[model samples]
Target: MVKQERAARTRQALIQAAAEVFAEEGFVTASLSTISKRAGVSNGALHFHFANKGMLADAVEAEAAKAVRLITEAARAWQGESLQAVVDATHELTRSLTHDTVVRGGFELAGDTTRRGEPSLRTQWRHWVEDSLRRADRNGALAEGVSWSDSARVIVAATVGFEVLGGDDTSWLSRQNVTRFWEVILPRLAGRQDLDRLVSSGSRPSAVVPSAERTSG
Candidate 1:
């Protein structure tokens, strides 16, 4: 039993260490040796816990998903908020999810993947984001006449763009600089009117666009 508990802790440590390193450095440059050192484990131990680098990457993604799901569940569990409050709550939830290190790292890794295909993990993230938007729309927080499913898709796409391009340029995510994003995009979405109330002052500007992209210049 003690051995099992120790193994679990070691696995979790590697997951966290890998996420941190991968997010800070592109996947190509992120080394298993660095992750092992960061986790305070020997490289052999890492191999024992994870079959290979790809397996560790998968574990990192799983940790990230769990972190994001927690934020989603928290927003859903809010019992007393009104429709506007709910939208506001969801907005906050998404912000936390986006900023989460584990969740954020998965995208950084996928972004650096050389394979010319979709990562299955990306579909899950998109579905989660879409679901959040749809829930807000169904609660009547969004304006009428907008297609919630499509709007959710667009919002998630826009979010990905923002995260990738806005890297260090938080200027776009600021209230003063990013209102243009809403000016151009909000009308197409369902919850603009409700969001106006929820995000009246403290709205997150936009997703942070990635800065210093290693590739895709």
Candidate 2:
């Protein structure tokens, strides 16, 4: 049991270290040795956890995908309007991008043309956004003449843009920035009744605590 727990910790640490290295140095340039060193583990330990750099990257992307799923799920759990749930999820996502190295790295990797794989993180997010908007439409939360497809496209583009820009300047991931974006779009996206109730600044304080803090706490 102790060995299993330690192995889990080692794998997690390697994933996190790989994320940091990949985020700072593009996946193509990041070295497995660097990731292993960053994790404070020997190269043999890293190899035991991940066969190669691609495997490590995959692990990082998977961890990030989990975080995104949790954020969207939490947002949908909200008791308020569906559109409001979208807004809340957007805020949570940006918060994760800003504070979570794994998330940020995974997003970066998703866009990295150097790597190719099935259903990147960006695809996952886009799909979720589309599904959520579709739900909102069924709930009559969207404005007249607004198609969920168009709304989902715009939201996905804007959020992905923020993620790309935030790589250089984290201000792009700021709550204020996300709030301002929703403030401008929610009026056009939400139905009259929903618009009045929707808070462009998010419905609650950010629940995306840093992964390290979450694990420790």
lDDT of 1: 0.60
Instruction: Give lDDT tens digits, candidate 1, residues 1-217.
Output: 5998788878878887888888788666888899999999999999999887778878777765555455445445542232332333334433543455666677666677552264544566577656666666666756678776776667567656655654556443344333455555555553555545543322334433221121112
Tens digit of per-residue lDDT, candidate 2, span 1-217: 5998888888988988889989998999999999899999999999888888888988899989888987888788774449888899999999999889899999989988888675799999999899999989999999999999999999999999999999999999999999999989999998998778888888876475446653432
Residue 64, candidate 1: how far off, in angstroms?
A: 0.6
Which window of ten consecutive residues has the lowest lDDT sum in model 2? 208-217
Tell me how far the alpha carbon of residue 118 in candidate 1 is from the true structure, in angstroms, after superposition: 5.7
Q: Choose the strongest candidate by TM-score.
A: 2
Runs in model 1 deviating more than 4 A are: 79-99, 115-121, 132-140, 170-197, 200-217
TM-score of model 1 vs. true structure: 0.69
For model 1, what is the alpha-carbon lDDT of residue 4? 82
